[model samples]
Target chain A: MIDEKELVIALKSQNECERAFQILVNLYKERLYWHIRKIVLNHEDTDDILQNTFIKIYKNIHKFEEKSKLYTWMYRIATNESITFLNKKAKKKNITIEEVKNQLIENLESDIYFEGNQIQILFQKAINTLPQKQQLVFNMKYFEDHTYENLSEILETSVGGLKSSYHIAVKKITAYIKLNETI
Target chain B: MKRRENIDKFKVPTNYFDEFENHLLNKINEEVLPKNIGFKTPTGYFNKLDFNIKRKNNSRLKEGKLIPVVSKKTFMYAASIAAMVLLVFSVLKDATRVYTLEEIEISSIENFINEGNIQLKQHEISILFTDEILNNITSNQSRLSGNQLENYLLENINDLNALLPY
Candidate 1:
């Protein structure tokens, strides 16, 4: 992997900028794609959002202030795009956010991506039970193990507040899994 | 801002069974690997764009030779239109009403005094005129009282002398 700072320097150079952006796209495409997929729960939707994220990053790279890492900025864009996609989908389908999430969970149970995976399938259901904010925080922290500082930068939130959010998310998911197993 | 030094205590590890971890790791590995941009884009694609750029550049170089002939006729047409516009404006300039300084000042004052009914409140006008009259009357009354008080004191001076002779 190219050093991030070096990649940024290349992005600022007159001729190497496009090449640097291509490198960035190759670097983050998969992780970002799955992150968005987990939110939207569809491979095709993930593909669309992933492409759009890269395109937006390319167009707005000049506006990036470098106060945060490039990864954090890209993650923020992916999160917003995924959330926006889900919101628009919910509106168009005339469904509540809760109903949409429950439907996604049901679909995830039978999803090709969830094939032959009992624990991951259950865990995804548990995550679906969480509120939207908690679900996002839980997915990043629990699965991706992204640091609270990086999450804070992407979310524009305080690390202390995020820690609480993660804590609540974990508590809720644990309760959900236990309750589901009992039933 | 509280220092989040030991927030890992909040992380209750879900039973990430070995199979689950394997599945997750496989997904991560698949996702993090660099995509082959040229894998599907095929070779010689960029070369096509370069060829197009060169062709356009050559065309532009040829167009540079034809500018002088085109510019002379464009400039003549532009100048003729500009002259016609200036002549029309000059002919109409006298018909446009031109107010003198005194006329402009008087009209502006009248306009200011009668700006609009929206701003001209009856109570506000009455209060303003009342304030001016009251101020004038108050000053005059004070002067008249001062003169009367002086006359009364002077007329009573002989009576005081008769009552208390030295």
Candidate 2:
């Protein structure tokens, strides 16, 4: 693993950028890809957003102020790019974001990327019913096990705010599953 | 309790990350290498772009060249107006020129008086015919003879007291 500060210094330096960036991509691609896949729910879409996220990070690395860890900044970019991609897909289909989510849920069975059992499918449906922010809060905490403090830095929100959103998200998901689960 | 069985539902093919870099590098090279960009440009836009930009810049440089030529023509018009004003002023001055008295001639007075209207009173005529000319006439014996004088005296004997106060 590359030292965070050293990677940042090389990323900011013009001479060593190509090699440093390649390293950066190699290191974070899996973690970032899973994080995006959780939101977008398909491999191809995740791959698409992941590519955009790294390109965005490479382009804006000079403006990285070293205020946060490099991965956290990359997470922030990945989060934004995924949201933007979903919104674009929603617009292209002339549907609201909620309608788009429902459509994605309907198409999950046929999607080669998704191989979840019935419970997992219900889990995805319950998660999709959430507001966009609550969905993010739940996914990062539940799957990635991201701490509230770290989530705060990546999301630029207060830790207390993140906890409140996370708890609310959990309650909603549990309630949605209890209400809708067939067996 | 059921939610606690947090088996991560998503999966990737084995060694996906191990192979991801090369694919990503290929994608990145296709995107970032400039020559193999993933985006498509309009047809022939590059072929025409250089010619178009240079034509516009050359037009702009040509536009910059136009200003001084117009100023030169304006300067020429001003100079011609000044010359015309000076020529008219010199011609008018010569037309009004004043000559010295030495340069002028006084013609014959008799010819001038004869040509012009002149009148004289009897007293003015007496001044012109002076007493000396009268005396010269009276003293000449050839002009009045003694016998003619005696005869003129006898003829004017009754008017002698009025004619000669003595």
Give model 1's DockQ, 2 decimals. 0.01
Question: Per-residue lDDT tens digits of candidate 2, residues A7-51?
Answer: 988988999977787778778876787788787776667766676
- C-alpha lDDT score of every prediction, in listed order: 0.67, 0.70
Q: What is the lDDT of residue A91 in candidate 2?
A: 59
Q: Could you give the fnat of all candidates in order?
A: 0.00, 0.00
Q: B1-166, model 1: which lDDT tens digit per residue?
A: 2457567456644654634654454445334322211111224533343333345445645876764655887899999999999999989898768877776777676687787634767787667776779789789877778757644544454222123211
Please tell me how candidate 1 rates in CAPRI terms: incorrect
How do the predictions measure up, each by TM-score? 0.53, 0.52
For model 2, the superposed segments whose C-alpha errors exceed 4 Å read B1-166
lDDT per residue as tens, model 1, A1-183: 579889888887789976787677667766786688778876656766776677666656777768888898788888877876676567668787678877876676556544434445566677777888888887787667799888888777898788777766666666666676657
How accurate locally is residue B138 in candidate 1, as Cα lDDT from 0 to 100?
Answer: 84
Position B112, candidate 1: lDDT: 72
